[model samples]
Target chain A: MAVMQIKFIDKIGEGTINKIESLGRIALFFAVGIIHIFIKPFQGKKILDQIVFIGSKSIFVIALTGFFTGMVLGLQGYYSLVRFGSEAALGSAVALTLIRELGPVLTAIMVAARAGSAMAAEIGVMRISEQIDALRTMHINPVRFLFTPRIVASIFSFPFLTALFNVVGIFGGYISGSVILGINQNVYMGTVIESVSIEDITGGFYKALAFSVVVTTICCYRGFYMHLKGEFGARGVSTATTNAVVQSCIFILIVDYAITFFLV
Target chain B: MNTPLIQLENISKRFGNLDVLKGINLSIYQGEILVIIGKSGTGKSVLLKHIIGLVQPDSGRIYIQGELLEELPSAKIKSYQKLLSYMFQENALFDYMTIYDNIALPLIENPDVIPSRIREKVFILMERLGLRGIENKFPAQLSGGMRKRVALARALITDPKLVLFDEPTTGLDPVRKRKVHEMITEYKEHFGFTAVIVSHDIPNIFNIAQRIAMLKDGGILFEGTKEDVFKSHGKILNDFEMGKEI
Candidate 1:
């Protein structure tokens, strides 16, 4: 009983600390956002580079994930609907799921795992090497100079990425149902277009916005506070990167559930 | 000469059970080379960190130009940070950025500096440091001594009132170490900024240090002019001179 009580108390303490850290991260994100407004985005060649990085380069992964997600939904919904003799409802199920939940959550997690971790690692390395401190001594706020562009880019790009995912996913479902399962092309297309409401689309977009903030904030926080109380080396940086991804993934899921619950 | 530019009074810092700096008091004058010598793990770096407000003292007061640093707001503290520069032990040049970018970082970050003028200043510093042609080269591509020089150039780029060097010559060959020592002297001469160097290289520092402070067991064991330091027969000083622990 005593050990259990101790564990409970420890958990409460941990939760409180996490809450404070979350608030701090929110403040940092807003701070970066404010700074980004003052600084102009990359000009000419640099703008082209960022466009290639955040948009064109992400196409293959985004499309692949979207397609697989749609096919999986089609396959699963088909079996469940057949039990109820409502197999035609597969299109509705696939469309709703793709727009309301899978679109934002999956894309966010994928980006967090790939790009977010890399950003954390890059910034973490900079922190440990005193490059961040060098920036401060030079009178440059690291938040404004280093983090603003990333946060701004993520906010700008993530919703579009989710939209791309949703469109591709619905098409994948169509290909699987119509081309492979012998459903009529007109029926599949009509069901997807008609069943996917504006509410569903708007809900997904909102979740994408939240997911972008969560992932970017967590990744930036992990990098910013990489060495808080003690000295952390390469191993620490790697661990922080891993933790950032895992935490962001978990946060994405929880936020997805909350948004879905409220939207429904 | 006219009230030391920086002062630490009753400064103490403890990391858990270990006390790193114990009630240390010192004052640093402008345009003077103050070398702090001690054995490894003697809190030399910690002392230097306190001066720059990087690590706050546990129970003491730090003043820059008679202004209490710890009591100041963060924005006020930030302004003070601009006047001081620290060259880390590892020559902490950002590895991902090119040499020119690393040197230009301070200028780029300062809101007061225009981007066009920043570029000009960076180029000028690069030229002066004999690093003009290697602007695109990363720190990984530079030699250890060259990296140190680049870091020094970055520190001096801001034209700071004070510059802190933490083990500036630790991992270099003798020739390279001498080169760094000479560079420190040259920078002091050129910029006329106060310097606080933490090092174990006694002979090299003796050439430039106007005053010397020896740290041991989280306290200042001795502090005086170079002539006084050499003339003293204190046991710890003598032991340190003879490469033995007291």
Candidate 2:
């Protein structure tokens, strides 16, 4: 029994040390990855390619998500405000909710699920196939060739996706409030226009930008270092991609709350 | 005496509890084909990776072109990488790229090579490799032999002085294997580049290898010419010669 207890304590100590070491490596990957942005010999073509992938290809999904979210917000806010005999505030509530929170948060989640996961899987496959090692052997830096553009593209895409979501969601909210609920159209539009200030809008952009960096960096880091775990072949890539998506989602939520807290 | 183009002194590496390479000491002459052969899981690839500075040694040193690899700064190391090319065992072709683009990558990355020169070099290589009509097709569309040839083309496009090949003929058919071996020999003769090959091709590689290094039990059991290995007697060497892994 005493020996068992000693073994358990040793396992805990080892686990803690492993966690610290992993965190340090992650921090190092991020520092170098971000610092590469300012350095010369940037690949303009690669960046453009990634932007087309992460930004343009993502528009349809973001629009659909935003429209549905706005409609739901308008429906929910109307019912809630009616209880207090203040149904006039329904438009403001729907617009504020869509613009200040759901726009950035929902867009981030979508990007994480769609683009971030794809990035992770693509890179994870590259790692498993030794294509990454091939790049290094060819005297090319994989981080610069593969990753910097991805991170930069994510940074470029998220804010634009967030803005699109806000526009579509606001329209959805307006349709639900005016056409469906019989709230005055002019009054709903007016309330939404008046309720949303520049600060609230800018706060959401800040959240979107921060959340993009966190998700992309974490996902890429997971995929890039997936080989270090000593696992090989398809299982390693699958596990790496799974970890990337799950970790990206978790970080997006955490970053969202942290940014929202600061803005509030 | 041939000057040592690359040297390893007391190199040792351990992956977890397994000592993959132990006290590895060897030298490759400036213009010779050295084949390092071993059983599967004997760290032959790991040793090849060490020469290119892809895998850092846990202890010991490696010298390339008279410069200690580890002593060079990261930028210098990258520049030094231009002097060498490593053709992967798995081919490692970019699945997203066409065969033409794949071969063109090394040349395109060099700013000194203009677009016309890049196209000229890439097409010439493709033609030499019997890959003319398939330039626009992606890697997934190619056969295993074609993929390997494409990778070889990519490696040689830069005109590197030293080339490392990890099992260049592993999954190839007999005809394709012979073709690959012939290509390596022809390229070496034409380019006069030194080669460090890791293979299990046995008699097939005997014709090409200037020296053979037999690895067993995580150490060099034999290192010399093919005739020297054929005349010697050892369990590991005989087993490998007779197509058995000990």
Candidate 3:
């Protein structure tokens, strides 16, 4: 009985130590990846390529998801506000929700599901196939060659993508509230324009920036260190990709909550 | 005797509880082709990786041109790396890159290599390796033998003084394997670069090996020329010779 109790405590201790070690490694990896962005011989072409991949290619999906989410928000807000004799404030509620919360969070989740998974899988394949080792053997810093451009692109893409989602979502809200519901179009637009402040926009941008780093760092870290997890071949890569997307989405929500708490 | 270009002294490595290499001591001379042979998983590849800094020893020291590898500053190590190139066992070509871009990568990365000469150098090597007209194709688009030649082309493109090859001809046919051996011999003479190869090709490998090192049970069991290996016929060596164990 005593030995069993000791073994349980030891297992918990080991798990805690491993988690701390993983966090330390991730923090260091993030710092090195960001620092390489400012290093000389900048990879301008690669960064631009990645921006196209992560931002430009994501426009259609972001637009579609944003439109549907905003329609739902508008429909729900109008019915709820009507019961309170505050139907005119429906536009403000929808705008605020989309701008402050759903815009950055949903956009980040979509990008995480799409580009983040691809980044992890691509890098994980390279890791298992020894291409990363090949880069090292050639004296090329694999982090600079692989991670730096992705970091720069994510930092550039996330805010732009969030802004796109907000615009498309506002239009969708207009379609639902004014066109579908019997709300006055001018009243809806007027409330939307009046309620949104510069502080709200900037705060959303800050959240977007934070979420970008979380997504890129976690995804890239998972893929880059896939081999160290004692898995090999296709299984390692699949696990890395799945973990990257799952972790990125989880961290996005966690970071969103923390940022919102401080901002509020 | 001349000073060895690279020397390993009492090197040891352990992966978890398994000791992949134990007390490994070896010397590699300049401009010589040294082949290391052993059974699979005997750390032949690990020993080669140690030379190229892909893996570091758990204990002991490695010296390159009389300078201890671990003691050198990072910049000095990079400079040392400029003098070396490694060809991986799986021909680790960038699948996304074209054949031309793959071969020209090292040259493009080196600040000293003029940008204008990269095209000419790549084309010349491609032609020499019989890889012309396929420069725009990606690595996955090429056959296995063609990919191996492309890997060889990339390794030699930098004009390195020391080249390390890890199982360069692992899955080739007999004709392609002989062709690869011939290419290694011909290139060694043409460029005069020291070569260290990890292979299991046995008698076929002996043709180009100026010196051979046989690794077994986590250490070098024999280190000498082919003639010396044949003369020193212990039971273990006989097992290796008769293709019974190795």
Candidate 4:
């Protein structure tokens, strides 16, 4: 039993080391992908197509997430305001929380779960079938030829998406407070605009950037190195996609907390 | 004569506990076709990977033009990458790209190769390989023979010093296999590039290989000229020749 315990500990240590090494490779690939943007200019149509797929197609989900997130914030803020005998401060509370913390983090988690998983699966299949190797043999770095454009598009698009989320979320809170809860519209808007600083908006943008980096890096890493050998096929690709989504969602939450802790 | 262009000295590789290659040693001069024959899972493809630095050996050394491969940094390794091309067993064509884009990929990615020259070379190679009209078609739309030809065209686009073919005729019908063999021979004659092909197609490959290396149990069992291989009397070779265990 003692020997078995020792072996278990050793296995855990090895697993930890493996995770660290994988994360290091992910960082390296992310840097390589960023550098590739300047080095190899792709066709404009390809870039535009990716933008449409990743950004425009994602708007509805982001808006839906924002609406629910704002409603929850308003409900929670109203209860807390009533406890403090300051119901008028509900608008300020909702605005501050949404712009500072919930907006970017929630939107990123949703998109990463939905779109990032599909990207990983597609690329993972490409990797397993030697399509990535073919690209290498053809003289194109897979990072440049395949991943960089997507990464760049995500970097630009996610922040814009986050901003859209914040806007829709604030409108959601406005509808909930002014129309349903019988608060004045002018006062609600004024309180929200006053309570949320430019710094808060900037912080959300920073978090969006970090979340973009995490999502794309994890997804691309899982796809690019799906299996060490060729044994795993479609099943492996599916596993990689699931892992990418889950890992990136966890990473976004953790990084959001860390960034908010430091910035706010 | 001139210190063989490529050399493998006691190269060994392992995946976890399973040893894939056990001390492989071989050499090939420039402009020669060396066919490697082995049953499935005997590391024939693994050996080809080591030649181009796609898979590194656990021990031993590989030399291309006498420069030790493992010692070179990645930037230098990439310089070597440009000089070699590998055609995967499944043809591994990028399914998303059209045949023309797939063929043009290597040329477009290499900074030294200009676009106009790349276009010219791609069209010329397409004509040569009988892929002239289907340049815009995706790999999914093309027949197996055409996909193999596109793969060949991509491999040759860079004018690599060495071209590696992995099971080039494994899935094709006999007629398609013959056409592929003819293409291989024609390309070898036209470009004079060194070719290393891994195949179990004994009867078909015998005509193309100047020399043949037979591998079994993670090591080379026999290495000799085609005539010598046929004349040699060993159970493994005899079984392979008789199509017993292939």
- Most accurate candidate by lDDT: 3
DockQ-wise, the better of 2 and 4 is 2
Name the better of 1 and 2 by TM-score.
Answer: 2
Candidate 4 lDDT, A1-264, residue by residue in tens = 999999999999998998798778877888888887777455456667777877899999999989878877776677677787786777888888888888888888887887788789888988888888777666677887667877877888889999999988888887777777767888888898778888999999999999988898888788888894244888889888888999998999899889988996
Top-TM-score structure, candidate number:
3
The root-mean-square deviation over C-alpha atoms between each candidate and the true structure, in angstroms, is 3.2, 1.9, 1.6, 2.9
- DockQ (C-alpha based) per candidate is 0.56, 0.74, 0.78, 0.54
User: Could you give candidate 1's per-residue lDDT for residues B1-246 as a string of tens digits?
Assistant: 567889889889998799999999888998889999888888998898888767778898988788887678999877778789999999878887799988987776556778899888888877877788899999999999999989988998888899999999998999999999998999788888899999888677788899999888889888888888778835666677789867
Candidate 1's TM-score: 0.90
**Global CA lDDT of candidate 4, please?**
0.85
Residue-by-residue lDDT tens digits, candidate 4, B52-87: 767778999888788887788988878878889899
lDDT of each structure? Answer: 0.83, 0.86, 0.91, 0.85
Work out the TM-score per prediction: 0.90, 0.95, 0.97, 0.91
Question: Who is ahead in DockQ, 2 or 3?
Answer: 3
Lowest-sum lDDT 10-residue window in model 3 chain B: B232-241
Model 3 agreement with the true structure over B1-246: per-residue lDDT tens digits: 588999999999999999999999999999999999888899999998889889989998999888898899989888888788999889999999999999998887665788899999999989888999999999989988899889989999988999999998899999989999999888888888999999988679888888888899899988987678768744666677687964
Residue A44 lDDT in candidate 4:
53
Please tell me which model should have the higher TM-score, number 1 or number 3: 3
Order by DockQ, highest first: 3, 2, 1, 4
Stretches of model 2 off by over 4 angstroms after superposition: B71-77, B111-116, B234-238, B244-246
lDDT of 1 at B60: 89
